[model samples]
Structures are given as structure tokens and as C-alpha cells.
Target: MNRVPVSSSNLSSVGYDESNQVLEIEFHGGRVYQYFDVPQRIHQELMNAGSHGKYFHRNIEDKYRYDQVK
Candidate 1:
């Protein structure tokens, strides 16, 4: 997936696959993760959020199945 860089304390970038409902997040430390069964609205909200990390924690984390990509 192609990811776009974002301004965040812990996150470096984010990407989404609408067809597959997968959300990929890359952290500053170089760790990347893909969250499954995600909604497009959530991905859009994350991109528009003031704090990506906060929004992820509040709405996404522990809410979907995920896998580490890097």
C-alpha cells in the first residue's frame, strides 16, 4: 500500500485499502502495522484528526485484527 506522511508524535504515515478494509500505520520508530476490517470513514477521520495517535488509540486500537508489516 502507498502511504502518505503525517504529522504525529508517534506516527510517521498512514495508508488505507478501501477494497480490503485495511488500514496501515507506520510509526516513527519504523514499525508498521496493518489493521483489518477498518472503515473508510475511520481512515479519513484519522487523516483529518488533530492527533493521529490519540485518535487511533481511542477509536482503532484493540478494535480490529492487525498484523505487523515492519
Candidate 2:
């Protein structure tokens, strides 16, 4: 499977599946989540932040993590 690099402003860690275009995120407080079919708008939002790392830390870290999608 191909994998893409995803960075989120609200995430401490990021994972991706290029074949499926899925993105997985890990937050600060043991939160994990998977975002599927991520729209370009959201992708841009994640990438274009001035403080991308900080945005992720403030918004998602410790909040959620990636879960398998049906």
C-alpha cells in the first residue's frame, strides 16, 4: 500500500494510506482517529496554518485518534 504524509495543526503525529487516501492522527492524551476521504478544503486547512504544529496541539492532541473505517 502506498502511504502519504499528513500533518495536522491539531495532531502530534500523523499517518496516511495513499492507496485509500486515508489519514490517521494521534493526539496528546492517547487519542487516536482516522479521517477518510479527507476533502481538499480540510487538507489545505491542515497544511496552510502558520502554526501547524501548535494548531494540532491545541485542537486535536489528547482528544482523538484513528479508528478503522467501514
- All candidates: CA RMSD in angstroms? 0.6, 5.9
Task: Tell me the deviation in Å of residue 5 in model 2.
Answer: 11
Alpha-carbon TM-score of each model against the true structure? 0.97, 0.47
Rate residue 13 of model 1 by lDDT: 94
Off by over 4 Å in 2: 1-10, 39-48, 53-70
Question: Candidate 1 vs. truth: CA RMSD?
Answer: 0.6
Error of 1 at 40 (Å): 0.2
Residue-wise C-alpha lDDT for candidate 1, range 1-70, written one tens digit per residue: 9999999998999999999999999999999999999999999999999999999999999999999989
The residue ranges of model 1 lying beyond 4 angstroms of the native Cα positions read: none
Report how far off residue 12 is in candidate 1 (Å).
Answer: 0.3
Q: Model 1 clash tally?
A: 0
Winner by TM-score: 1
* Candidate 2's TM-score: 0.47
Candidate 2 lDDT, tens digit per residue, 1-70? 2223445434555555656656666655546667666544444555566776775555544544446432
